[model samples]
Target chain A: MQEIPRQTEFVEVRGRKVQWTRGGSGPDLIYLHSAGGETEWTSFHNRLAQHFTLHIPAHPGFALSTGLETIRDIQDMAWHYVDLFEQMGWCEVPVVGFSLGGWIALEMAILRPHLIARALLVAPAGVRVPEWPYAELFIDNLDALRRLLFYDPEHPAIPQALPTSLDDPRMLNWLRAREATARVGWNPYLHNPKLPDHLDRIRCPIRILWGREDRLIPPAYAQWLAERLPAAEAVQFESCGHMLPFEQEEAFCQQVTQFCR
Target chain B: MQFFAFHLMPWDRLPDDFEQRYETAWTWIPNSLYEPGHGGTLYNRYLDELVLADRLGFDGVCVNEHHQSAYGLMPSPNLMAAILARQTQNVKIAVVGNALPLYNPPTRVAEEYAMIDTISGGRLIAGLVVGGGPEYYSFTMNPTWARSMFREALDLILRAWTEPGPFEHYGEHWKLKYVNPWPRPIQQPHPPVWIPGAGSKETIEFVAQRRFAYMGIPYFHIDFFKKNFDAFREACERNGYTASPSQLGWLVPIYVAETDEQAWAEYEPHLWYFTRKLLKGLVVLPPGYTSARSAATIHRALGKFLSSAQTRQDIEEGAYAIVGSPQTVRDRLTELAKWLGVGNLLGLFQLATLPADLTRKNMTLFAREVMPQVRASLAESGL
Candidate 1:
């Protein structure tokens, strides 16, 4: 698996002091994580950084930044990226995300297609598959969750233990951010029910890659996108789960790099 | 043996005065074949019944997925499971789960199952199933993919539970570099798994391989279940394993009363609800909604029922409801237990819109009289 290089830095976007890390400057690649935060997207970012200038900002309330009261929801985070794009003066860039960040990328495309040259969402959320309830699975048992999310338990990427207690202050802060986002994003246990219809509104080319074993969001939703997204294509990763960005980091990066190019 | 019951609670009338704030926001595909009242009290009653079932002592309640029809009120069983978790206790909540091929990201199924397990104190029976035909219409998912996805989702979820964190899983249909899940299950290995079937040879063969409980949901005669149970046993024998009684179960439409006549009369309306309203609504299934095997099984079952024709006698003879007094129902149940050799009998007490008094009578009678007799008989037979 290929690894993306990581660097921490800050930049002045517009008048506000926003924090972002820029690596391997070329065509900028903006990376975002899901509500759980940016820790998971790092590998994908590093791999993309090798080819394009990878720019990953700690999404508001993520990483070290703490200016906002709460992350609000995925849409607000999408706007935050739009604001970042304007501040950085990037004419157009390829945006990539894993899980929740993938959902955010789709939202960003809907909000401003010009800002995003292209999009690659890995196991993205927001579209509800008729037979599956993505949001409701969060409340399901671990085993069912595993079977539902991942294609293979033998895969190297599936995690065994989840953080049980988020008592630490940093973890607590992370929880607050997640809670804010979930408050806005969570409902009906399905992804945004309206997402399928909205896909046509996104003009940029979209590519979705899913782990066949992705236990978190079934890859079938990706199929729905392929059918509905007017300008979308999708691929399934063998023996992967929701955490495909890290589990299949090399292939994930390669797929994104190729798609963006 | 362990206990499991399927409940789709009954709700008679929806209050007229309540604000219709949620009407436009929510739509229900009626269980009835024909579109009856578009999003009416009947829908609200279905939701109410599911929530109430959690409060009842039923081991594990059942909910199914249907599209554009209100036959089974829960189009999203997971959502209902979430609500039930908050409302009930100790009772195992079952969502017969998302029809795999109809689901996207399949992980949503994983996440929701995990979340529900965590919330329900590990009292979750992971009901993984290939959803029936109506689901394909609602989601427009190819049925061919549904079976494969169902298998793939099961494999992945099992791996997530037993395997260590942050692993990679890749498959042709679904792929992921990382299979790690945060907030892993409260259950050590995973929750118990259950599968509902319409008695397909492939399904019976498949469930027998895992020794997972096979829930026979024929919607008609107990003899139909006998055939499936026999097939499952045969499959087990072929696989070099002796089939255990606990591995089998049958879902019978149940209603009890002080007298057999009263039970039969009261149960007729509810039976009418399912046959006239519910089963009729499910006639049209989307393309690629069922496997060739499942389609064949459904055709066989529907053919049997259709051949019998829809009549007052067929409905009265327990085509959909098993109506009788305590001993009479017990005798019928005992005959079924002896013939099917099942350890668990999942009494589907709620059939459409039966009155609450009769519903309570049915459950109370079964718990008080039928269960004890059934357990005693199983013990005495020593099979």
Candidate 2:
């Protein structure tokens, strides 16, 4: 199958230039990215692009996104997206959120319950599992990050996806992404401390997905989130780590398609 | 020339294989490594070195803040300064300085500094810092907020010291209905502000613009120091004022012995331990600690910690440490100080693993022999 063409575009939202890529032709679906800010229109994005119109914003402060300084925390990030969505006239849009993006989506659902119609949260990190802590994302160990993100050591794209070279120009972009994540999520680590209490506000139908073998955020969190959010179901993928969407891309997309349809 | 004895008060007992075993000397350094029994002795011994510097004719005694590291024992430099202020006479007590962003309601820094200043007859050089990257990790602080928090905290601290009481502060990071601190510093308009920085252009400009004393943090090539010092002068020039010698300081590790060879032998292993073991994660700054441009510049200098700066020759080549006979030490320091256009010297006499006796003797020799000659040289050389 041929890859879909993606158009990179930008718009000013709340004094920040928010950059996102758009492609495909169907009902609107936003693909919120992971801590890595998943800029590349990869297989998961491409697969989803075929069935839905994909609007992937680089979550201000990721690559080419500006005005990250204006954002204070994860709550601020949710507001930025909400403001952006409101400006774009995007309402009742389904979102496929991955990891950090998933956490933001959960925030959006809880904060502005009507903005999102439904959400597919893949290994979302929003609450702490004290016994099974989220493996560190904001750290000096890129090797550990990659290992935590991927179940397969020999994943062909691991080197390309998680570049380790400091000298590489791509590192600056990666740094920007991580810095954005850190800005929003550093203090309480990744999860908002008050999020679980207000999980009842997430009125949107949600499918909380997790990799059973996830190392970064344990699969137990899927059940934890499922028990909290209103009208949410938990699903676990076999032989997958935190990279649930990438590791089980087809199965993940099939589930998304079924749920969204 | 002004002289200050600085002590890192490092835990000197990291296993010999620390470089091989530990990923870093900082956060996540197993707490079991710290023995309170030995720590109690180290604190006093280190303070004694600073006190001895005071008894001697050094102009000041400097202490700084670091956390969860063998790098320095003083997480609260103000405490050390309080001790020096009370015990020592005549010398300035430079808490060079407090990591500003780490403190909540940063007014406490202002209050404590003022208390020390009042108690010590205005003998305080207030050093404010945004703090190092590892501190952000140690504190679990958002590095993105670091500079903003630092600027706000600094502004709040200064106001708390200088402005009248009961004023309100509405900053992005801090909000106070009554932004005031009692016991405002004894030195009118607060104590002389000293800001220590590596070679970041932002820091140089920030320091130079305010004409605050900018102490160059040590452990880099002399050329890097030269570049930063030169840049500081240029920055001051851009600010439409030539920086006074009082506005520039250099922190360097200095040691002297009976012979150059003996100095090298005595200082080499300790310098190695200081650089190789204690400085493990320094280069790995958390994202948003500094602007990328400055990070590049700062990292370029701090990269020396991981470089081939292992042997004494490598150390000297980089000018990472200054160790030699009294004559060699005197000449090298005088020449460098004059060349760098700096008037204040913060010397770390007690490096990692340098014993108390050697440290005391080193301070004595420096104060007695090298200082007078260096001062005379610079004074006579018309610098």
Candidate 3:
């Protein structure tokens, strides 16, 4: 398959330059990145873009996106995304969110029910099941975190997706992204305490996707989260961890493409 | 020329295989390892040692904070400082201090510190710190906002001490309708501020800009201290002033005994317990705990540091701790103190597993035999 080139776009959201990427030709699909904000438009992105217009926006305080200090919490982040989308004239779009980004997507679907037509949440962080709490990603060493994040730490795509050493230029990006995650999720530890009670407000059809091997947040919790929401279903893929999108790239693109469509 | 006795109040016991069994002494270390029954006796013994330091004529006795760690028992240094303020007369009570950002309304720090300053009868050396990386983990504090929160907290505390009450504080991290703290610090213009750093350029600059005393946090190679002290002096120079010796302090663990050989036999195991076990994983910098530049500086300095001093020779050479006879300790301390150009010496008299009696003996022997000689030597050298 020939590579489909992506175009970069920027819009000022609340006075901070919010950057995103656009490619392919189809319905607009908002793609939210995980804690280690995705900087590269990888193969999975390209695969998804083949079927849908992928709008990958880096969260505030990650990579080229600015204005982390402007927002206080994940709710604020959801609002920031709303502002970004409104400024870019994107409304009532399908949203696919990964990990921390999935939490934001869920928050948006609940907070502004009309803005998201459907939501695909991949290992989202905002709802906690006491039996399977999110891993303490902030404190764990990199090697251990990698093992927790991926089913196969030696996967070929991992070197590009994750940082191995402080010497790597991507170290700063990882650090900044984790810092932002901590700012929002550190206290409740990736979950908003009240989010579980309010999960019923999200009217859009939602998919809670998880990897069977997720050690970060136990895979069983995906069904647990799905059971709480009004119109949500749980999906689990094999041979992947918390980083299901990258670890099972082909399956993820196919799943996301199918769900969002 | 000033000796301040410092105590980390380390847990008096950890299993001999603590290092092998546990990856870190902080945060997630199983709390079951800690013995509740032994805690009271340990706390009382640690307090008695600091009191003994005061009776032995030390200028100050210091207590600092740590959280969820077997490394140090004092999660609230202010509580210990308040006890010392009343229990020990004539010694300055230094709470080196409360981790600024962890305090909900930083006025809590202002109120508590003021109470300590007042309790100590104006003898308080307030040491502000951007807490440890482990603290960021333990407290769930956003490491990225650490410095900003620290700076803002310091400003709020200073304003609470200096400015009049009912003032509105509309800051980024903290917003208050009215900021008023009663029983303001007894020290005019607040207590002497001491900021501790481990060779972070931004920290040194922050200390220099305010003309606050800069304390070198311990356990690095002696060369690390040299580089940091030089950077500090250079920072002061940039601020259009030469940093006085009083503006610099070096914290080093010190032990004294009847002979050099006896000192080593007495102190070696405890020093190992400290470095190998207590300090393990203490330097794990949380994400965005500091600026990237400062993190790099710390990494470079750490590359030179003996993380867990490999040998007695490494310990001696790095001056990670000074253990010797009265004569040997006096000579080495005077030489290093002058060489480092520091006016203050915060000596850790009671480190990990040093018994109460031995700690008292070390403090007494140092005060009686070592401190006077070192002070005289420094004075003779016009330091």
The number of the candidate with the highest DockQ is: 2
lDDT string, candidate 1, B273-296, tens digits: 555544543543222234333544
Please report how far candidate 3 places residue A219 from its true position, in Å: 1.8
Range of the 10 consecutive residues with the lowest summed lDDT in candidate 2 chain B: B299-308
Per residue, candidate 2 scores C-alpha lDDT tens digits across B1-383 of: 89988888899999998989998988779989999999999999998898899888999988899988888888988888888888999999988788888898888898999999999999999999989888988999889888888888988898888788889998897888997677778898889999988787888899899878898877778888888889999999999998888888888899999889999888878888888888877655688887766765565565564245867777777767778999999988987888888889889999999999899889999888899889888887554
List residue ranges in candidate 2 displaced over 4 A: B306-308, B381-383
Please give the DockQ score of every candidate, comma-separated.
0.01, 0.59, 0.47
Residues B1-383, model 3: lDDT tens digits: 88999989888678999889899999878889899989888889889888888889999999999999999998999999989889999998877878899998999999999998998899888888889999988887878789899999999888999999989998888999989888898999999998899888889999999999999988889988988999999999999999999999899999999999999999988888888888888887776787655775676677656565788898888898899999999989988988999999999998898888788889999999998888888988766
Off by over 4 Å in 1: A1-261, B1-3, B9-57, B283-294, B306-312, B315-319
Recovery fraction of native interface contacts for candidate 1: 0.00
Q: Give the candidate order by descending lDDT.
A: 3, 2, 1
If both were scored by lDDT, which would come out higher, candidate 1 or candidate 3? Answer: 3
Candidate 2 lDDT over residue span A175-248, tens digit each = 77878888888889999988888999888899998889898888998888898887999999888888877788
Order of candidates by DockQ, top first?
2, 3, 1
- What docking grade applies to model 1? incorrect
Highest lDDT, which number? 3
TM-score of chain B of 2: 0.97
What TM-score does chain B alone reach in each candidate, compared with the true chain B? 0.84, 0.97, 0.98
Name the better of 1 and 2 by lDDT: 2
* Global fold similarity of model 3 (TM-score): 0.94
